[model samples]
Target: MSSGSIFRFSVMAAMLLAWPALADTHTPEEVPQTFAEGFIQGVGVPVISVYHLAAMIGIGILVGIAARGVVPVLAFGAAAMLGVAYQLSPYDLPADDAFVALTTMIIGLLILLRKPISPRVASGIFAVAGLVHGYSLGAVVANAGAVPVLAYVTGLLIVQTAIGVAACAITLGATKWPARRTVLLLAGGLVIVAGGLAAIEAAGLIG
Candidate 1:
């Protein structure tokens, strides 16, 4: 065979072999599983699932664009808080953890309305939110045991960091008033609506 053909054949064989290994490394688990299992089963918990992850990443990019005047450190602090909130809180379809979800929405809206808060302030807010996020993971760990818990939390952290980085990049690139204002307005509206829904749920108005 020609060199090109041989190279193609080798590449195909490698991919074929790699496929099974990847599958073995990431098999799905049975139901009644912990939050982490659910997260890992979907391949990460950054925002509960792929759809949520995409939504949050989009939100982060918008927030970054709106907050362009801020430095990377500050922008990242805000983004990280949002990321943790999106990931750990049970805001998925079934909507578990209404309290955390409500709190996150309130905080997100506050950030959207107010000018870029100090990095110190953002950091403190994120620290408190992070504990709630961590506790959500701990709940999973307590119920599901170690391995699944680790996998779930690891996936969440990896996705959270990536989204935070993307948000910072968006903020760095924003330079126009119209785009920034639009993002802030839209994000603010979303937070308010989501917060309202969460509040209702927390008050026992929703299932």
Candidate 2:
């Protein structure tokens, strides 16, 4: 079947999943019970989450400053799938929170400096961040049915790719400006602060 067909079927499945819930008078918003709902939730959830938003901004900067191809972006998406798969499994990844904080901070540092790392290293950073973030994202749909999960993944990739590409484009364009370095430094500093706060919160040093 074509990808479009598969997506249509997925949506149909989600609607079927919703029928019983609807008949029972359950609140759809209480959980993702439709493909459209799941996809929207997936797209908006990451952007709305403060820590993830900051980290994503840092990621976009890293991508933009590198001025490389989409390999890093693709790597992130692929690795994110692995993370979500793991979350769907019976196991829990150890030290995930610490590792996420570290990655977030490192990406911020790189962006703050406005220095492009090697493509290989940059892709690795993207993968690590994607894995951790995806694992966390999976929690939202952990108990969801197959169709909603599929829709969520689809929307997650679409939105994230858009964000990464948009940021990279802007950064690339900004490179010609005289104060490009200063602008990059300011953005990176913000990411660093966001990452640091995430780390402190994870460590329970503060609420």
Candidate 2 wrongly placed segments (more than 4 Å): 1-30, 205-207
Model 1 TM-score, 2 decimals: 0.56
Q: Considering only N, C-alpha and C atoms within 3 Å, which residue pairs clash in candidate 2?
A: none
Candidate 1 lDDT score at position 127: 50
Query: In model 1, what are the clashing residue pairs, if there are any?
Result: 64-171
The Cα RMSD of model 2 versus the native structure comes to: 11.9
lDDT of 2 by residue, 1-207 (tens): 344433433332233234222322111235578899789877877666545655665676678788887778777777777787788899998876666677777877887677777779988889988999778777778888888888888888877777666666666666656556766676666566666766776787855
Instruction: Name the weakest run of 10 consecutive residues (lDDT summed) in model 1.
Output: 19-28
Give RMSD (Å) of candidate 1 vs. truth: 12.7
Task: Predict model 2's lDDT versus the native.
Answer: 0.69
Q: Candidate 1: what lDDT? A: 0.45
Question: Residue 38 deviation, candidate 1, in Å?
Answer: 7.2
